[model samples]
Target: MMGGNLTGTVRLTRLALRRDRIQLPLWILGTTVLSSTSYTAVREQFPTEADRVTALRTAVDAPAILMLRNAPTGTSDGDMMAFQILAFLAVLAGFMSTLAVVRHTRQNEETGRSELIGSMVVGRHASLTAAMIVTAGANLVLAALLALALIGNGLPAAGSVAFGLGVGAAGLTFAAIAAVAAQVSQGARAANGIAAAAIGAAYLVRGLGDAFGEVQPDGYTMTSAWPSWLSPIGWTTLVQPFAGNRWAVLVLPAVFFAALLGTAFALADRRDIGMGMLAARPGPARAAAGLLSPLGLAWRLQRGTLFGWAVAIGLFGVTIGSLAGTVEDAFAGNEGAARTIRELGGGGALSDAFFTAMLAMVGAMAAGYVVQAMLRLRSEEAGGRVEPVLATATGRLRWLGGHLVVAAFGAVALLLLAGVSAGLVAGLGNGDLGDRLVDLGAAALVQAAPALIMIGYVVLLFGLAPRLTVALAWLGYAVSLVFGQLGELLNLPQAVRDVSPFSHVPALPSADVTATPLVLLGVVAVALGAAGLILFRRRDLAL
Candidate 1:
């Protein structure tokens, strides 16, 4: 019976591979490139044993850095690189796996494609089995590539393999979690949201445990609490790839993946086709009074997401702010640390440099929310939801304008919230609230230009090439994020650095704010936006 239920699995897996060729390659390539580049940069930055030791000492005392990265395990360059990139790599792998599983499973069911496939000779479990197989294969490939890249960069082969396997295990665990989420949520969006929340919760649990964990006298070994064991991300770092390479820690994720996969399959067997195990409740029969206009409807649709982003960003700001003093104290006497900070911050006051980097990070995060909001237009159009609305008195311009306004203004509000929260927290710690609030708030606001440019790019894609908008929009954001954050570290070419809009924004607090670049960026944003609106009004809806 089980064998029959997986009929046509190979064919379906092949089909999925074909469909995701571009996306899968991009995900793998981008991750590998980032990891490899980061490793190379770290090696170059700290060339001697003394420098590595100093960095390890600094990282040990700084809780914020520990929360962001794992405690250094050894003075070896490979160990340092592994510690620096493990958390980031684990998160990336989980994100890739979640998106792949949800896109193949829940998204297909939502669009009725799975139903069509089921009507053929395929069995009940074939589609999901195929998706799992393809996703697992992609993760394995990513793991192999990352391992090979690490070895090619002069790292130990055994440690590289351990790191790669740890990352891959995290991805597999999340893929199974996403599969279970797909069975529990009624729609693709909701499934993705649930999976994302799970990922976020896991990271938070890991970060909290690491932040409070006890470190040995060596300043390299750490012993985390029970909360660390609860998160698969934490498991990845616990493997300790370069220092001791705790082979047993990998078993945690293996067991979790098995349990989650079993639960997903069981849930799938109990649910109806094109529906989830958890049924959604029906909405009220009458629309609310505030749902009269397109703008109101847009707000109604996006308010939940906007609220979530605002809270998350604000909390993140506060957390980073609270760690600023610890970071400064940790690096006070270290010349290598100071030089590295100056180089990364483009040379300035150490405290200002730290804030500048934090604000830039917040800006990148805000761009993600802004791009998501802007992409709602493409989603509505693709789902055939826009036709009915346009069939009424509402015109294309009004509908587009509604979402655009939210994307723009919501970006501003979220940035302000993050800035204010960080400033307030840091100010209280330093005993000067008013001045810190204004300065940090202005810093966050200056970073908004990149997000605005991101929206402009998405709008342009939606109008000129609606079918390619989603992929290209996200690709643009990813490029900007990588360049903006790591360009200096990687010693990337000037032209490459210039590609990101954030690169033009003067690093506030660290340096004097110049108006020329800001004005140029604003002009470019307006031009792109105007062109998009014009093209959207002229062209017929692709759907």
Candidate 2:
């Protein structure tokens, strides 16, 4: 009976692998490249043992830096590189795994694919089992590639293997969590959201633990608070990759993965074919007046996601802003600390530079929201929901335009809220509420131009190649973040950096604001959006 439950899992896994050939390779290769590039960049930036040691000391002393990155465990080059990039890589791995699991499991059920497959000699658990297998295999591949890349970059084999294993473990843990979420949520969107929220919560918990960590007697290393132990991401860092090479820490995530996988399988056994453990609430029998139009329906679909992003972004802004006034005071008498802060955010008044850097990060994140919102078009089309809507009086252009409008306005609203949230906190802290609020608000609004460009291009992709929209849109955003934000640290040339739209956005508050770049970006956004609308109007519905 148990064997029958997993019948056809191998074939299903093969089918899944074929379906995800492009996406899996992109995620694996992108993560490997980012990790390897960071190692090279770290070596270039801190060319000597003494320079790396100084960096460790500065990082240990700075709580804000600790909250954003990993605590250093040693002063060696490999240790410093892991400290610089491990936490981020772990989060990336988590995303890669969760998306893969949810896509192959809940998404297939939502589209009736699982039901169709199940009727034809496939076992009840085959689809989910296959998803887990494919995603787990992808993570293993990612780990192997990352290890090889680091070893090729002159890092020791042991530390490189530890780094890869840590990342892979985090991915496997999240993939299991997502497997459970798929069985618990009524729909693919909710399942993905739940898993993504888990990822965000893990990152936040890890940040809290690191921020409150204790600096060691050596002054170059620190011990994270207990909260870090609760997060898989933190567990990955606890491996200490190149620092201590604590291979035993890998067991924590492995246990977590096992427990969650068991729970997922149990839940799958209990639940009905197309139902979730947490059933959806029934809507009113009568439709609301707001559901009458495309715009209203768009708002209905996007509002929940937009609200979530706003709250998250606003809280992040508030946290960073509250620290703004104290930034200068934190490193006041230490010229080395001040210089390090400058190197991180560029030369300016310490507080201004910090604010500028935070806002720039906020800006990059806002683009992600835009991508999610636009990808809903692909979801609707692929799920066969768009055909029914188009059969009505609604025109194709009008339907696409409705979602675009929400994405555009939602992007701007989020940026404004982030600006206001940060400015309000910083102003209150510094006793300059009026001036800070106005300036930071404008600075936050400035980010919208680049984010608009992201929306335009994603929509363009949706129109041009509906099948590739989801993967290509996210890949483009990742490319922008790497080049635009990390270019300086990576020693990438200006020509290469220019590929990201964000590289052109004026880094406000720290530098003088410029309008020419914003104007050009706006023009490009408009042109792309117009082209997409026209193309979408002419193209057949993907379903």
Q: Estimate candidate 2's RMSD in Å.
A: 1.6
Best by TM-score: 2
Summarize candidate 2's per-residue lDDT along 496-529 as a digit string, tens digits: 8998898887767777888899999999999988
Per-residue lDDT for 230-330 in model 1, tens only?
Answer: 88898988888877889899988888888999899889899997788889778799999877789998998788789988888988899867866675776
TM values, all candidates: 0.91, 0.96
How much lDDT does each candidate structure score? 0.82, 0.87
After superposition, candidate 2 runs with Cα above 4 Å error: none
Candidate 2 structure lDDT: 0.87
Residue pairs in candidate 1 whose N, alpha carbon or C atoms collide under 3 angstroms: none
lDDT of 1: 0.82
Model 1 stretches astray by more than 4 angstroms: 220-226, 320-351, 428-431, 534-543
Best by lDDT: 2
